[model samples]
Target: MRLIAGVDIGNSTTEVCIGEIDNLGNVTFPASASCPTTGTKGTVVNVHGIKSALKEAMAKIGKDVSDISLIRLNEAAPVIGDTAMETLTETVITDSSMIGHNPSTPAGAGQAVGKLIGFQNLGSARQNEPYILVVPARYSYEDIASVVNRINGMINIEGIILQADEAVLVYNRLDKKIPVIDEVKQIDKVPDGEIAAIEVALEGQGVRMLSNPYGIATLLNLDAEQTRKVTPIAKSLVGKRSAVVIKTPAGNVKENVLPAGEIYLSGEKDISVNLDEGAEKIMKTVADAGKINDITGQSGTNVGNMFERIKTGMSDLGTVEKSDIHITDILAVDTLAPVKISGALAGETCLEKAVGVAAMVKTHHLPMEKIAESLRQDLGTDVVVAGVEAIMAGLGAVTTPGTKLPLAILDMGGGSTDAAIINENGEISMVHQAGAGELVSMLIQTELGLEDRHMAEQIKRYPLAKVESLFHMRLENGQMTFVEDSIDPRFYGRVVLLSENGLIRMEKDIPMEKIVQVRRDAKRKVFVTNAFRALKTVAPDGNLKNVSNVVLVGGSAEDFEIPEMLLEEFANYRIVCGRGNIRGCEGPRNAVATGLVLSYVGEMK
Candidate 1:
């Protein structure tokens, strides 16, 4: 009797499977285990996670590490996923044309249009026209109301805009009922004599007029071309509870092109392409470059730092020469990055157009031999480095109950989307594409403006819910779930992470609907896009129609929606796609580990 342990180290997880080989060379596996990868795969640190997983598996069967006959560790690839999704695009703000941003609390109702004037000058303004009061934060509501009520007898005071949170107090104490907008931190920046429009919606609702391009055009009396130009401004102001728009001179709205810089693809002949043409054109150039020698970015630019970081990190690894690292694939998604407004009435952000690039670099050498030698010395057990990861995954996937060859396996793991096709003759053709689960998490973090990485990770792992009331909450799908006790006041009327530890408030000021949209859109961009990209490479004639079956197997495969998303995307080609079932019990895990044991048997042949 012999007990063999097959361990597979991944970008995000490490798994193990223990099997017993009989006298007839038949293997019966009884235990399997998994844990988070301790560190970068193929490094000395990974031995910790591998041993931890093996220990867990051994504990299941009441056995110790010494009972294991042999340990098989995977030959991990050199490339780690760089989840940088940054882009560059340009937009110029003409004067103080618009203020579009979220303010924690806003008060008032309806819209007001008036000639802006200094609050102190209200005493001297013409009584013939309506005027909007601009109250600075220095003055209390008592003084503001005292001045405003006294002026109402002289002129038609339409509405009030305050730089402090006294809207309700002033509105309640006033002799007249008018819309009030507060928290205008830059109240002094409002041009003294410019015509402006202010809109404040009722509680739980958002401003509509200023967010509409036509509404701004109508208020400013601008022509068609000018209205079209301010569309971005209106679009950015969409969910604000209140907004202010002012018009400036024609040239005030500047036009500047965002310089995303250029990339140099080193091949037989190095060719450079501007990143503004987007990832499609850049990748087409890379495809034409046979045997990518290297890739470099322009100096003193975002792309420059990205490439430099990858090179420096690879250099720090001390295994692969920095010069030998080649970019194998790139995925670019057009996205908007939020940038702070320089000076504005409310805390404002301009959505700048950017290209989020996820790049995969390939190295000429495999760094697994060093890891295997180190593991052997540390564990007091013989360790063998297996062949290519995709090949092992495909072999393991064949163990699925109803699997047969000429089949393609979509090994959707964090850091990389690997695909492998096993022909009828048992030959394997495989490739890896960058952008996976971690990339999805990066997108969620950036789009939602979350600085906490752990919060973003939790959002990626769990479904979101909005705490509508104390007793019940509505989930992302609009299903209502009831809790016996009232939710924490901080999470009330807010989107929350429904984690195992209870509800965690999403600190961002975005709504539940928007958060759900960002998360789903991100998953679609990474998984749906990479699925087609990965399958096209291994399928005959580079067509997805040729591949009949796709079994998803990886840490991400267990996701509630990813498999469904891939299935929907692959439905067009009539390909049968589903998550892999390894050993009929390990849903999408243990495939690579199970295959390692089978591959060791193959080596004996």
Candidate 2:
């Protein structure tokens, strides 16, 4: 009997499979293990992760790394994916006129318009004159509430903006409640003695009056031209719980359509599509240009800077010449990114329409041989680069029990999505495309305004639930479950991810339904779209209708909803699509590693 081990080094993980082959050439797998990859794929740094995984798998079989007769590694092509967001338009305010933010808790529920006055000057206000109080953090919430109560009959206080986060506390202590907008970090920037309007929506609602441009015109008595200029301010205030719009003589808001620039596609023919036109048009232009050999962006523009950053990053990671690295594929998705308004109080952010692009970098060579030689010397065992990644994955996919001869496989991984088809004659065709799990996570993070990458990844990888009570939780599907033990208070009344470690509470104020919708939509925009793109490239005659069986293999295939989404999409074409079970044991994983060993044993026979 001869012992052999196969290793697959990927962008995000390293997998190994151990097998024993008899003299008759029959093979049986003994053990398998996987761990996070040490560094960039196709580099010598991967040997650390490879050795760790090998030691783990060997331990499972009561053997050591030295006992393996030979080791096989997939010929991994280094794929680097980089993403950037280009906002089509930006909101610039010349003066501090608008404070539009969705504070977690605001006070009161109404609209009021009056002259702005400092809290220290409230004592000198003329009786029966309407004024809005601007209070600083030096004054306590109790003192503010007490002073407002004392001046109730003498001064008409329409609203109040506090520099501290005491809106709810002050509102509750008041004998007469008024609109309170707190957490204004730059309260001193408020245009004192200017006419201002404040609007606070009730619970579970957004501001209605201030979010409308005509409504602001009615409150501030502005003409058609002034209303047109303030329209961008209103647009930024939409969906906000509380907003304040002040009218100043020199205040102006300009909605600038930024020069996002054009993408130049060098293929069978050259084509240029401007990013300002949006993602759909850009992608359509890309499709019209067949087989992209190189992609470039307009110089001195947002996309140009972004592409330069990507090129530099990839060149450094792969240690290749910058000129040799060509962007061969691009995936663009429409998204609304949170952009901070130019001049606004309270650090306000507005959702701006952006085109998020994921670019794929391909080079002529990578130092995979260096990695193999390093491993050979360290382990004192024979190691060789076996075969292409997609072809090997296709070979391992056929080992699935119910699969047939002519098979197709989609290796949905972190950095890129790869597809391969094997015919009965053993001929293989493969294609690698940009954008996969990482892009999906980027979309989730940008759309939901999440600052933590781990939270966004969790949102992408698992299902979500809303803790309805201490004992019962409502899932994304609207089903409720009861637990015997008391749940953690931190998770109470919050949308939590149902992850392997347990209920992880999401700190954002997003609703469960919206989170679920964003997650599924992101998956559809990336994976489902890439599935069709990859399958068409590898299918006969570039037609998905001609393809029959498709097995999803890789880490992303194990996601709770991605496979189901693809299965539903492929169903229309009568394609049998599902996650692959490698050797009828490993589910949607270790396919490339297993295929490396299988291909070696076949050569021996």
Candidate 3:
């Protein structure tokens, strides 16, 4: 009899399976253990998690890591999920600058070119100048409107800016129709005597003049240089219903680009493509190039620096050189990044469209080899690199109750999704693609325009609900439920992330239904699309119909709704799909580890 152990060091987890095989080739798994991955997959830092898991699995049978006759580790691919998406929009402010934010319920839709003036100081204000009166909270709507009407002939009052919610009321009483922007929380901050351009869109429309840099230039009579300088602020306010732009004092808005350099794809011949063209173009070039041996980024570009940094980091590890590192596969997603508007008050930001890239680098399997040698020296046990991760994971999935050959498994992990199948004849085929859990999280963060990644992660993991009342909450599916006690006041009137811990308040002002839709849509877009793509590639004849069953395994498999989503999608093709049950106990996890043990005994079918 021999005792063997399998350790699968994954992107986000480290799994271990321990078993004994008798002379007859029968296998019995006595214990298994798993821990969070400590560092990058396929790196030396993973030894911490591997050691911890190995000790735990060995302890289950009253044995230690030293007692194991041999150890097997999966050949984990080097896939890195890069969240460095850059936003293209920024705020630019020149002299007399104004920042625009959406204010609910403005009155009298029309564009007005004017000079902003203080309401009280209008007595000293110059005549023949187009005037936009700024009203404070201390004055009543009735009194202010009456005063403006009385002074109508003497002053050219084209627009009104108010601190209170009285834009409609004041507009109704005015004899001369004028645009009014009300509910300005900081009305006192509007500088007087500045060249102001106020635009209130017609109901159901958006402001045009203030949103366009050229329009602002036309209204403010700014030169070409000034218009170029003000473009960022205009871009920042592009979609608002109403906006106000003022020429402020000499604060410059420099639109800086993070150089995500060119991608060098090696195919029929080597060709370089710009990363700024986005992922679609880059991947298309890669496809056209035929088989891509490796990809690297341009020097000083964002992506270029990213690749260089990865090489520099690995080189710092002193185990691998830069040349041995090869980017085997890459995944990119369209996303948004927030850039603060220059001279923006109240921390205004614009969500700029960007591409989030995740690359899977092949490191000549030296990282795994180093790990094997280290373990052998430390534990006095023989160690070997089993094989590719996807094939091993398929071997592990067989340990699931009632699973058989001629089926496929989708390993939806954090960095990449792996699909593999084991035929009845014992042949195995596999493929790995970029995009999975972290990509979904990136999509959520971009769509929701959130600043905090921790919140974005929670949003990805949980369902959404609106804390409508203190004692009742409206679920994402439009169902309402009552609580025994009143909900927290902080969560009231806010879209919340319903995580395992509790309700997490979202700072962004979005409806719960919208938030829920974006979250689910992002998952469906990444996982469901990848699910079919994976199945079709690995299935017989490259058709999904050829495969009968698919088992999902990985951290993403644990999501509350991803499995259901994939099931519904697969149902259309007459294929059955469900989360894997490794060893009939470990749910959607440790499949590769168990497969290692089976492969060791040569009992794998």
Candidate 4:
């Protein structure tokens, strides 16, 4: 008997499957294991992870690495996926600035228009002119209230801007109440002697006057052109609880269309589409290109920089030159990315329209040859680069119980979603498309404004809950569960991920329902959309309805909800869809590894 191992290096992990072939060319799986991928997939650095996983798998069956006679490595797809947020719109404060943010408890309700005067300058203010007090954090709430009250009627104090979190305390102490906007981190940025308008919405509501361009114009006595210029500033304050817009002599807030740049597609016909035209047009242009031979971006633009970065990184890792690394496919998704507005008094961010793109770069020569040779040198075993990943995955997918020939498989990995079909006659067809789990995580991170990538990946993988009490928590499905132990106080009243290691609290104050919505929406946008796009490309006659049974295999296929989502979607087309159980033992993983061994045994036969 000859023992062989199959190692599949994926975007996130490396999987290994060990099998023994008898004299009759029969093969039986013995063990399997996985570990985090050491570096980018299909690179020489993957040899470390490949060896680690091989040892782990051998140990599972009480064997040593020397016992394995041969190692089969899946010809890892050369496609490299990279995601970037291309902001189409940017808020630029030219000569003026604004502070529009949601403070926890902004005091008072109503709009106030006055000249922005420092607390010290309040003493020298003109009695006839209305002035807004910009108080520094050095003053106590009592001191600020006392000073504002002392000059309330005498100096016409109309509003208050506090540097500290004392809006409620100061507003309550004032004899004459006025709109109070607090938590101004950059309080010093507020220009002195500029006309300013402050608005505080009623409890549980957003600011009105400041959120409207016409309202800002009416308050600041702006002309038609000036009102048009401040529209972006008004848009930035739409959902704010409290806001302050200041009018300097030459100050203006302008929303500029960023030079996101254009993408050139080379195929049957060279086509170019500008990024400012949005995702739909870009995708349409991509589709019209028939088969994308290569893709390039406009010089000196966001997309240009993005492609250059991707190519440079790939060239650095593999034998391919930067010029030879061509982007084979791209998935452009419309998104609202939270981008910081430039020159804003507060560190405020606006939901700018953006296109989140995932590009796949493919090279003429397979990059896996180097990886296989490196592993052979280290392990001192005959390492052979096996069949294409999708083809091999299909061979293993058919091993699923109740599956037969003419079956289709969707292998949704971190870097790409690959679809393949194995017909009864043993003919195989496959297509690889950009965007998958990584893109989904990117969307979740950007939409939720999360800085922690681990949190985003965990959120994408697990369900969420809200810690209502020490004992009970409400799940995303609105079901409540009580635990015996007291939950951590840190998770109290916060949205948390129900991970295998217990509840992980999210630092952001986003609501449980919104988090759930965003999580599911991101999945739908990437996986579901890519499912249709990929299936159409590989299905018989390029039609999904013509396809029958589809077995999902890969890390993402094990997602808690993605399989069900695909099930619901494919139901309309009468396609049998579910996650694959590789060899009736492995669930939605090790398909490519298992397929590698199976293909080798077939060659032996």
Candidate 5:
């Protein structure tokens, strides 16, 4: 009988699974175990932690390490991806210089020359005088009507240039029709005392008299050279990026080209790009072309370098050489600082940075020696990588299929939140975030002034209960029990121990109520918020609307309220939330190891 083991090394904990594959290709998971992850993830810190988890899992299956024939490990990409989400929380006003307005159709033939004034400012004495009408975005059609009605007889209201949609509304409201452009983003940028032309075209209608640069100049009684000046403004507002444009009626518009190129790199090394080309040129460059580096001196996300790192490490270890190792098949999800691109026309674009989780082996026939070598080099440590064939075989297990074409597995471990997305097309994306259970523990330790990370972790993991009297006590699980004998007075009204030790008091007289409140709030802020943010970033459009289900696994997911809280936050998207059943017993916590094993089987096939 051939047995395989899967081990997932996470930031807070390491999970192990053991499985057996029969001659018919059916896999059975017999046992699973979880222990705190040793050392920093992606960095070789503690091998003992991982070894202990392996031993515990092996013992559960009633087998020793020698019984295992082969092992599979997930590709340990050294880079960690970090992500942050911030919405427009406040609105601030700035000095108006640019306007973006859209007017689908406008009336009149050419440029209208006149003094600009607000709709309300027009009066009777200006009836024959040429004028430009200005509209504010906030005002409704009704509001514009009231102002126009009051000054109807006093001003000519000769030419109407309003906000994008307002043009149509104002046109319908007028007794006599005039040239109007509706969608205008910037009404504040309209130059005062300038000869501006408004271009309008109806459905199936070409440019009118106002459409020609010279025609507008004729209408405004300007010389040919002067008319050329206004033409530029009229055309500027017509394209995709332009929201609005106000120019001299005679100015002409011209288009210019910018040359560019793109550079792609692979590996964890940092790189720098020299800005030999112009900013616009850089923006136009395509992906995976030209020279690039692993580590970029400029701050930004680098996927190419991440890919290179994983590949180099794997290649050196002979994983790709001895077996069919496919690096491109494994999606690299980065959760890192947003890369700040300096020479792009779009301004500072945030490039996705974190390269956290990766799936290396596929097919069961791949050689293990090469796999181990690759893992050691890439992970930068002496590695013992293993894969289990099945996650539920020995235990009383129920197999539940998952919904959602692209499913995300979130390993909410202690030190970090590891996430991976497996699309229906078999494409996998993964990322590792730095802050996780450890961050929560730090918060609790700092808030309550506790010096111990272990104590803080326990407090963050469990709930609190106060011991009211000697005869009765409360538990963190919300259950109450009675004691036969009188307990110590110090334990009364203090946090009660749920362990076999009975009631015990906390050190230094810390209040149970304060401890509970602080722990709960801290966990919610760190874990829940980070989970949602991570999921959204990995989602197709960075929106949860497309994601309906989130599979949560890890030591942190064991918390009773954590999953429920996630369900509530993602309820709007109709998401079904639950844990992964590794070996039919360990929920959602052993997916990486299980996946690692499954990846091995695919390699053999």
Candidate 6:
């Protein structure tokens, strides 16, 4: 018989499952064990911590490191999203330069004579001609409106050319029956008080007599060479996505293009994928695999970086060499806005900032080759990484098999909240966001001004029991315990941290009731709020009606009151909510690790 050991290294714990495979290809679970993960969820590798877990797990199955024949590892991906970029508008100070003109729609274009006011005086100014409004593209609609209103009385306002959306609104409000084109390519640098042409297409109305530069030349009685000048402005409006041509009676407009290039990633195989059409497809492909064991740079996540850091730490400590470390499997879901990045350069859209933020919110999984490898590396001997959605699906596969599409999974971990949606076709959508158990602990610490993070964590995790008078209490194991007579009333609701001598007390004489209230409130804000938000974000089409089953997983899911709290909040949707029954024994906490083993088996097949 061949034995396969599935290891899952998580952020908080390491879980190992030993299974035996026979010639028929059936796998049977033999033994399983769990221990605290060596390092911070995804950050460091503690060789000693991992060794302890491995020893304990192996001992359960009466097997040593050499009993396993093959090993698989998961890949890690880190991503960042939801970054805000603020740009200050209306902050340019420069000498008036350039001319810009836009006409909504023209009927046979012609040049009009005009003088530029703001920058026209720099050159020759024609006092006896109509003036055109030259607006820059960078200005906001309000700013453009203000400028137009300010020059309304002073200038003829023959046409209002602008850089922003104001042009459309301004043109709509024009009193005269003048032709207007919406978007003008370049308006800032039009020459002042010069003879220029504005062109407009006449669908069937033919060319307007006023639109013809020659007509203007006839009216002004200009020479043939001078009449040719307005032709350029008419030509500029052609083929533009949206353009407005104002027959500038006097000024000329010119257009120019800017230089830009795309950046690509260095030292790796480059792949180009269009984000607009490809994001959902790619996400679906990754999700449908039921389980993704290893994804290198292809998927970005917070856990990926955590595993890399642990690997580096292990190598530095001489516990394991870099080559010995192998990432067998990795599960990462993009919790970012739908922004795409191409090559190595910033995306033209808001994707750059999203990528930056996703990089900060990453997670990963790693598997050692053998028991000695784990012992030497000082990492979690048992490691499993799976998307929260996949875990929920596995649970649903066991509990409610013939359900509808798009089942939801709310994974309330210590550091962050994760939510995933699995559809009937096995397509999955997942999201990770800040605010979970750790956030609750932080709130408690801050509100109560406690210095011990451990104390805060304990307070957030367990129920409180106040020491009432010096009465004898029965322990869970039927042991009798007696408290001291001189205990403060503040310790009435607080649990006793038994020491070598006597019961411990908090530094501050804060009431236990207040602490319990604060703790509960913190959990409500961080976990409950985050769970709802994450669920809404991951559901297909942002509709909750599609999700009928929500399986809770992760350490936080084990909280006695948390599951009920979520059930109450999500009751409106007629959804069935409960913890995952991993292997029909372990609770939701082992879902990831168990799923990792199942994923490994599937990949081998």
- Name the top lDDT candidate: 2
Residues 1-605, candidate 5: write the lDDT tens digits. 57877766565566777778888777878877778765444334434665577678889877776566665555443333222221111111111112322244554433344566665455423556666677767778777766666666677565666665666667677665666666555556566555444445545555454435565556556666555644532232233222222343321323222211122323342222232332222222311222222321122323333334545555564323423433221222222223322211122123222222232322224343454665455434444554322221101112325444467666676545656666677566655444566556656665565556677766776566778787777776667878787877877777743544443346634667678777776667666756775676577777777666677776778776777777777776787767656545556667667776565566667
For 74-153, candidate 6 gives per-residue lDDT tens digits of 22223111111111111111111212222334322333434434322423323335665556666565554555466554
The C-alpha stretches of model 5 lying farther than 4 A from their native spots are 42-47, 77-404, 475-479, 485-490, 497-504
Q: How close is every model to the real structure, measured as TM-score?
A: 0.84, 0.94, 0.77, 0.94, 0.48, 0.47
Model 3 sits at a Cα RMSD from the real structure of 5.4
Note the Cα lDDT for every prediction shown.
Answer: 0.79, 0.88, 0.80, 0.87, 0.52, 0.48
Question: What lDDT does candidate 2 reach at residue 268?
Answer: 85
Q: Which model is ahead, 1 or 3, in terms of TM-score?
A: 1
lDDT of 2 by residue, 214-312 (tens): 989999888888788777788888889999998887635545544788889999889999888887788788778988899988887878777787788
Distance from true position, residue 304, model 4, in Å? 3.8
Could you tell me the lDDT of residue 133 within candidate 3?
92
> Model 5 residue 422 lDDT?
63
Which portions of model 6 show Cα errors greater than 4 Å? 41-48, 76-406, 472-507
Regarding TM-score, does 2 or 3 come out ahead?
2
TM-score of 6: 0.47
lDDT of 4 by residue, 532-577 (tens): 9888888888888889899999999999999999999999999999
Poorest stretch of ten by lDDT in candidate 1: 87-96
Worst 10 residues of 6 by lDDT: 348-357
Candidate 3 lDDT score at position 147: 94
CA RMSD for every model?
4.1, 2.3, 5.4, 2.3, 20.0, 20.8
Clashing residue pairs in all predictions, respectively, total 3, 0, 15, 0, 85, 77
Q: Candidate 2 — which residues are off by over 4 angstroms? A: 94-96, 102-107, 123-129, 163-177, 183-191, 202-204, 248-257
List the candidate 4 regions with Cα displacement exceeding 4 Å. Answer: 21-26, 90-95, 251-261, 300-302, 316-319
